[model samples]
Target chain A: MQLSAGARREGSPWTGVWAVFLKEVADHLSSTRMRILEVLILLSAVGAVYAGARTLQQTVSEDPFLLLQVFTAAQDPLPSFVAFLSFFLPLAAIALGFDAINSEYNRNTLSRVLAQPIYRDALLWGKFLAGLATLALILLALFLLVVGLSLIFLGVPPNTEEVARALLFLLATLAYAGVWLGIALLFSVLFRSAATSALAAIAVWLFFALFWGIIAQLLAQAVSPYDPFRPESELRQAEALVAFSRVSPNTLYAEAIQVLLNPAVRSLGPVLITQLQGALLGSPLPLGQSLLLAWPQLTGLIALTLLLFALTYVLFQRREVRA
Target chain B: MVIETQGLSKRYGKVVAVEDLNLRIEAGEVYGLLGPNGSGKTTTILMMLGLTEPSGGTVRVLGLDPVREPLSLKKQVGYLPDSVGFYSEMTAWENLAYIARLNGLPRAEAEARIARVLERMGLAEVAHRPVSAFSRGMRQRLGLAEVLLKEPKVVILDEPTLGLDPEAAQAFLQMIQGLKAEGITVLLSSHLLHQVQAICDRVGLFHKGRLVLEGRVEELAQRVLGGAYRIRLGASPLEGLQARLQALPEVSRVSLEDGEVRLEATQDVRPLVARTVLEAGAALHSLALEKPSLDEVYARYFQEVRHAA
Candidate 1:
């Protein structure tokens, strides 16, 4: 019944959410934490792109999509631009949002803020939109910078399809960052201390980024045992392992980017030799097919973000706001 | 009524913060809620603001149910919490501007109102200074400025003078009177009886989550103590003056200590007592009618209720 009231009222017009959104955006932009994270991300991105551009030069004469390799190619001691993004985007998002709600509570300004004529829906939505906007802006800038640097280094402009695919990859990366931001926001709502929320968010990121692949491997070994006795069982075990790992947003991001950036990769799982008999060995798939391949991963990231956001909205609305 | 509550109650699981409370405040009246700690003053204020849903009953402000029309109601009602906290990193003007935007004021109008309120609260010089550098009194004044930003019809303040020095408290009380003169309904809550007694037109004494006594300060004191008069004699050792005062039929009871005589009388017996003191060879320095103080009234009323229960 409360949810229905909330839902019905959700349609009612609110003018103040935008004010909160603008203020929050300004606050996030001016924060020292965001500044530090921005600097760190820029340094890593520039390093990774420079490293990848140098490696792409060797294959520039034959490869028509040489610039696309700036996002995927990696040499020793440095990963690609996309790789650095996959590693640092979540950190930036969590840094931006880990104290989004709790900081207001701790500062004793939340109750006063809510006491204004605005509804709680506006407050939560505004903060979320501001954070997402900040993340999107930063991601867009970094993607353009990488593209520009690659354009100069590789001396080959990307074709329409390649540009489209890179843009899609950037969009996917934003969604992945959104998922982590939502997780961090959920922690912010659940904990009163900013330090606690920050620690919880990092703990979750560490689990997914560092330990999840190993855990999924161990889980597959335990559940779908490797019976070397049966050759088919090996494929099933590997499939089980990938399936388990897909639950982590990191895995989804990596898989989605691989599909978008590498058009030669047609499937996320193993394919039979007979199934690929007529397929061109190294020809890149069309952009539409790649998007179709990455659609499920993109949907997974979006759903996770939505689920976290919904939880935050409901909890924040029902809370007393006494602090 | 500017504000009305019908059988309002809030139960936090097993603990009832406020219960079966009914209050009616007319327009332009300064109503003070007087109670000790844990007496449900804050709970009542929260319920009235529609911040916390009541377990039973309803609250109406400006003829609109706060729960049903909280935004509309809040637009007309300004509230100052016991301890006001602003965004420390922001300047006072910036903080007020943020609240103004949230309240749906136009940018130009908000700027004008922010400047006006800052000047009125004597913070115009420091309007651009960060709130973190403000003292407690300055913060309290800034809080008042924030409350007045919207030109609200009703203002609810919870212990607006909680941490102020004596001089600052006096200034804050004077500003509250200014609010009253502007025809705004103010519902203030505080445990400082004397301060409330000074500015409040009518007072409600809350005990154990219930409104035990509600009336004007002087009327409540008279109602509780029955017109008892305290007379302070000029010199000590008024040994026979006490007996003579007790013998007068108008005086119902008499007690003497430290050159002061406290007498309970059903009517004004000051003239009769003065005559008796003079005839008894005792100098009558001062004789005045003494109604019970608001502090005594609160204490005695709470004690009687405790004893009865």
Candidate 2:
């Protein structure tokens, strides 16, 4: 009688999201790829931090922000902690997300999973949230490790401003990771083969990280040729270059980190000589001013992440599951 | 009716995958969708499960519209897709547990039901082993166990016994019969006719996106073959036997093959043919009646369609 009347209660679209999220997190934690990436990041962090502390102790022992210097200071033959992260974080995020959806197709499990009493929204959201949580866990542990190393090397705890700035830097890093995760997820939905999606995600990363800066420089020069007679032309050229480079997420993340970890960074754009005439030189800005300077780049990264994820959602919902 | 589709049609661009399929299946009946590959059997199944949207018409499973209420419809329908896959790294129990959680089953009840289904599927001994180590037959049974975990009212299987050996295919069909015994409606699709013919209470023959014929297997055989029985006779002297067999009132047609006479008739004509052979002064060596087989029916139906086209 109930079947004839069709009075079955409808379930929510998010009914099974938590279960999917937990299972994905467990899989990521136990996977060999995550283990390899964790070791790679940890080794680079320890090496960079040790080198940075040695250089900072010799050069800036009396600085007020000695704790922050440990993150920015770099010795010869090695880059700073920020540089190492900018290079490795994208790879880590890509590893977590490149095969997220296509692997389900490859294994022929997509239809079986979708046959349950849940919507496709739950599956996609669950996988994305799980990736972000895994990235957050790794980044948080790395942050604590760096701070503890700073305490041992500098022989002083960080001030409130320094801790706040460092936390902002951590948030920016996570957002940067999210951008790459979105790209990987997008490619996973667009391509049915896992290998093709993985390669596509890596290709996007490579374009932004290695080639985008040079391409921007060339394009800006072509658009706004420099003229010696008019110095304003040089400024216009420089502004064009910055605008073009900002389209790349790598550029946005790098600028945000520079302003958050180094308090002396007061402006992200080209500044005139008259603007700095009355300002004290080499003095650190307050935490609020530093955050204001990095706000646009920070939001840009988050927006890009959201845009890619939306596109991926649309493509995934339209995909045929028979493959 | 437990499953009904009215004028259901699906089109991808200009290609019509399924067209104007009007199907109705009653509760607890084992209905077979019989066709060769690319005949739209799988496409129809996908529409019924709400995995693919039909370009026209409607589908109702257990009185719930699949497109409008997929969540509730899917909850009561168990689907075993062709070549069903699993998380090979996880144990069979772990995989089924994930499905249980998705179904919103409580932890204790999920565990108890999982154990029961695994045991009934003969997978209890290997429940803790990773699915990568399972053979093809074992994996299919595991897929069936996963389907059973939901306690669904209707089970739709797409090519359930596709690649199994003869013994395993027989065992699998037995399990399908078991589902029918429990008063569950089953809809299975397969290109292999004879395998499904043994179990289906009623079958629909599909051709080029259309249900060309639908009825009970015996009825289909009568309609396609033009007769339900074929009688074969062997005698010492086959000269006048063919003429005598053809002259009988009940026999429709008679042909001589391999020194024996074959008769196609509407009903049992073995006794009448034997009497005719004896009356002709020929020694009766062999006389046997053959039931019409699904293979013959399917082949003959397609031949007629080709001729008509």
Chain A accuracy as TM-score for every candidate: 0.94, 0.94
Chain B TM-score per candidate, please: 0.94, 0.95
Error of 2 at B58 (Å): 0.6
Model 1 chain B, poorest ten-residue lDDT window? B228-237
Tens-place lDDT digits, model 2, residues A1-323: 12444545366778899989999999999999988988986887787789788898678337777767777878888888888888888999999999999999989999999999998989999999999999999999888988887788767888888888889999999999999999999988998888898999999989998899999999999999999999999999999999999999998998999999888888887999999998888898988888899999999999999999999999998898898
| Candidate lDDT (C-alpha), each | 0.86, 0.91
Q: Give each model's clash number.
A: 0, 0
Please give, for residues B1-309, the per-residue lDDT of candidate 2 as tens digits: 999999999998999989999999999999999999999999999999889888999898999877668898888999999979999999999999999998889999999999999999999999999999999999999999999999999999999999999899999999999999999999999998999899999999998899989999999988888888888888878877787788888788888888877889988988888889889998999999887778778898889888999
Candidate 1 Cα deviation (angstroms), residue A74: 2.0
The alpha-carbon RMSD values of the candidates against the true structure, listed in the order shown, are 2.4, 3.1
Q: How much is the lDDT of residue A309 in candidate 1?
A: 99
Stretches > 4 Å off in candidate 2: A1-11, B233-240, B255-262, B279-285
On the 0 to 100 scale, the lDDT of residue B270 in model 1 is 70
What is the DockQ of the complex in model 1?
A: 0.58
lDDT of 1 by residue, A1-323 (tens): 36554434322436588998999999988989778877876787688778887786665357766767887888778877777888888888899889989988888788788778878888878888899999998988887878887777766788998888888988998899999899888899999899999999999999998999899999999988988799989989989999999999999999999999898889887787889888898898988999999999999999999999999887877777776
The CAPRI-style docking tier of model 1 reads medium
